[model samples]
Target chain A: MPTADHATGSYPRTARTTPTRAAQRASWDRERVHGILDDGYLCHLGFVRDGAAVVLPTLYARVGERLYVHGSTGSYPLRTASGAPQGLPVCVTVTHVDGLVLARSAFHHSVNYRSVVVHGTARQVTDPAEKAAALDAIVDQAIPGRSADCRPANGKEAAATAVLAIELTEVSAKFRTGGPNDEPEDRELPHWSGVLPVSVSTGAPVAAPDLAAGVALPSYLTAQRSTNA
Target chain B: MPTADHATGSYPRTARTTPTRAAQRASWDRERVHGILDDGYLCHLGFVRDGAAVVLPTLYARVGERLYVHGSTGSYPLRTASGAPQGLPVCVTVTHVDGLVLARSAFHHSVNYRSVVVHGTARQVTDPAEKAAALDAIVDQAIPGRSADCRPANGKEAAATAVLAIELTEVSAKFRTGGPNDEPEDRELPHWSGVLPVSVSTGAPVAAPDLAAGVALPSYLTAQRSTNA
Candidate 1:
């Protein structure tokens, strides 16, 4: 029994997007997908190399339905996308573990989490206008108003970077919340059973050793102190 | 210039273990490798399916040089691991992002993170003694002192779970810390430059809806609220 995403159109579930376990928790809603992507700045990128799979941690940003990831032009995987007739097939995933569900039975122990998985063929972004725009979105994703605060890339810097665009066509988000699901027989066990909520918090800002004088922490960064990001 | 692990002989760096960028931040020390692995409970498992790479988010537990991951016997990837003579070729990576580096120049903006990548052949754990130990370690990884509190898996439940062990023979840890590395010319820009430290914290515990009477929150869980998990 999948729940409907009343806020936005649902992405059609495909063979790859279907959930294997806890089917009820899976969602294909566009708004739910975008919300998960927006809350996280890092992603795990999976790609094939020499017939074996390699997973790398990379920073990514979402703009509308397109996700952008940039790397050094010399990187091997980025080179694989440049001349391919069919784009490189990739899987991008973002996960946030919300809490730990401690159950009386070890078999039922689980974690509360929200995750979005995007499967698609990614291609190199060549258009200058789109590439620059994608870069800005990447910066803004990290800091809400960062792109405007930083200096734009110069010609030399732009030429040295490679950006890939992956359209959010086949996407699915899965989430689990609430307390432990201990079995009926194990309910009276002496063990403690509950949910320990987990969150990512931003600590105090540390200025750069070489930061120029008279430049203090901006209001935007200060505001982050109170937020969960 | 890689640092030596004074206690254990450092894993020799091969072309595959070396980083393409920021080579100075890469370490092959065994202690460093274990530190990063012990700090994170989740990992991204990458494997090839139908000639395309797929990455799945999974829970992982590390015991010495061996890492364990388990799934249902009916899962697609678990089936692939059981029958193969040479086992499944996979990459397991765990990452912890410590901070966001906001620089005056977009090119220098980066994240402070610690990550470990392990590449090897993962084989199904068939030994009953090792299997039981691995399962306990998996539970303890998510919550310290948890395995002792929960009921051990019954014969029926144990039969349904499949665990894989990957040797940590080829591993590398990479990290970036401190403030942003803006170019010298961009230092005087009005944009604020600093490091926003990030950490995972546990919130107040929520008891199960059907929790039996008189099962108070244990000291172990209460202690978690004060620590950054």
Candidate 2:
């Protein structure tokens, strides 16, 4: 494996971004990081709140190398980050569980997953234009082309929402892809050994109870369900 | 809709655990919390490291009111936690995305998810009996009855692993279900509105290249795929 770069083309391998163990599973590739990030809309956003760590599952979208997280204006992270002079230090993590690796030995059991961890100072998006775009990006992330189909946010609606932006300057993508890597001696054990593949699948769309009569299911949504994560 | 319990039948909600907004979506019911935690094995664990917040995706299991997290003995959280006299303060979060709500208005779009957030001081489990049991619970959480089917860890493998236990003292479960909750005025808009139900589905098991010929796929593995996550 090539050494992580400080961004000729990859993210900077800052001290905290480097892995101390299982270095083979970690990558700083820009495109790989984006693919993992783009595959999901929800992220576990972590921030130190009142001297203790807090992790919240929230919506997020990627625009180039920056991430915009959607939250309520009253949410703790949004409120706190807006008040900080230098922005609140935060970590945003996205994960897609690909499979369950059940080995002959319990010690080697694991999940094959693709995950990206981003460390940065989260600054609230205060500019109106940027905030609007961020919200659109978040909506589109969940259902591609969704933003164009829905009504744009009015002033009061936009006021109630919050967006926090974090750059992908210090980030790393770590993943495990193959079958169970059981030890040589354990390979001959009788227990079943293999990868039980798992993935997010969209079921038939359930229309809202109060949806207008003439509205039809969108084509983009139909397309989204056709692909597996 | 009830006040959070400090722990008669529910985990007490501290100031931090209490919801500052969307109070209706938060709950301290012990059973509800357990159901959310048991739905997934992968969790985003957050801890303060070197004056900055770091979040890592890891495996965790619930046993009664306690959580046992598995990691390499040399992993940062395990190593740092063992050195702490009073135990390391950490937060564990689990989320299961149920659906994607596409409202008539972009501002109202959201995800249907069940999430549990646990805040506690993590202590390294040093007792041999407790450690072994925790490992069993961890494996069983992933696949019920799996721990009994596989070879138990040998001394060297067990020594290389670490189990960090955290009591479910301060906890909260927040969730959103049902279809899009669009504004009344927006309900008649031209946009289609509904929830794209999503779920984790397991695929056919792929046997390891060196898997023994006689070992049959476990009954539980097949059953797991038949149910919706």
Candidate 3:
């Protein structure tokens, strides 16, 4: 677990101090922060639209206690949220794969995953430097070394993209890892009861068809690989 | 992918025939259903709470074209939506992990994942038989063989759980898989590149401490040692 004090000035004003049953798994320590953010690349953002609850899947990156999410400027919720009076009250979640739980019974079976959920108001990041940094975080989050691979966003392209900054306050992380937790009586059943570990590994990079012939794969690209946490 | 046909009489009435650009993906088909659902065990269920958007994480199961989700009757939104005047509108989403793309350039870096989003109104399932079946489906979804392992829910237990069923209608699935697609010129950068495949697998079973000394593990539990999809 990462130390809570590290949050210091980076902590959002609304960060929750009292932990609840759902949030009892682990404190939002630094390790927890990086673990949840680095392991998972996607997040589900929940917000209100037209008096209804809407959850949308989007890409996100975590920098310290702040999370950055970008989407097309034309997205309704993003557009509306950027200009909303109270900003957008949003719930953002990230999850990482750890293992699978093959319990003795279907009801007992579950997946092993690490997830973090943050509740906060998301405001559009307008400062050019901030926006650039957030974009880099988002980019580095997906592909660690790819930030320098492509051309930087031009002013027009940057203008067309909407970036939302959400301080990681009032956050909770819950994780279910390790093997199956089977009921006692069913232990003697005739079946194979061991774990079959599932893992993700990088394969050889495939160059884009449009790439020039002489371009060689970057060391960052070739060195990128998965590691067991 | 499972067929869009519904086993129960209930079907989506206002499903869109064609998915928009936002909802559309490079890979769109029924065959991708199980893979997407299996990859993501948790989903964000959106519902209106006091005219505000409330999205929460919940466990779900996919049985054929139907997705089953349930929670305690004491939960706020579930309780409220069950008795609401017109039922609550909801959007459910599930996503799977493929790999992490560590690109040299931030803009070009990205993650590869498979996701499915279902948009529809959630109608309270009042039919006792259907509710029970839905619960079974939920359990089966978590663990394929566990449905038969544990005792069926008694009437009291059944009453305590609120289950909602949604047909896989008005559904859209999107996926981005494979290594990073970096730009041409940055290929020679010293940074490493390539995909880090991510996956979830089952581990050894852990029995609850309160169980009797010699309880045997059920075959259903034991057989679930590997990833199903």
Q: Which of the numbered candidates is closest to the native, going by highest lDDT?
A: 2
State the lDDT at B120 in candidate 1.
82
> On a 0 to 100 scale, what is the lDDT of residue A130 in model 2?
97
B37 Cα displacement, candidate 2 (Å): 0.9
Summarize candidate 1's per-residue lDDT along A71-162 as a digit string, tens digits: 67776667888768587899898888888999999888988888899998889888989988888888888778888888889989888878
- Sorting all predicted structures by DockQ, with the top scorer first, yields 2, 1, 3
Model 1, docking class: medium
Between candidates 1 and 2, name the one with more favorable TM-score: 2
State the lDDT of candidate 3 residue by residue for B1-229, as single tens digits: 2444434333333333233344445343555655677654568787755554555667787877777777657666566668886766787877665656655455555566777777766766779898888877776665565666555666776777777777677666777766656666676655455555655445555654444456666666565443322
lDDT of 2 by residue, B1-229 (tens): 2333534678776898899999999988899998988877878889999888889988888988899988888888899999998998999999888888899998889888899999999999989899999999988887778999999999998999899999988899999998888999898899999999888888888999999889999888877552222
Clash counts for the predictions, in order: 0, 0, 49
- lDDT by residue (tens digit), candidate 2, A12-68: 788888988899999988889989999989899999987889999999999987999
TM-score of 1: 0.94
Winning model by TM-score: 2
Query: How big is the positional error of residue B205 in model 3, measured in Å on the Cα after superposition?
Result: 6.0
True contacts kept of 1: 0.83
What TM-score, to 2 decimals, does candidate 3 have?
A: 0.75
- For candidate 3 chain A, which ten residues in a row score worst on lDDT? A9-18
Interface RMSD of each: 1.2, 0.8, 4.8
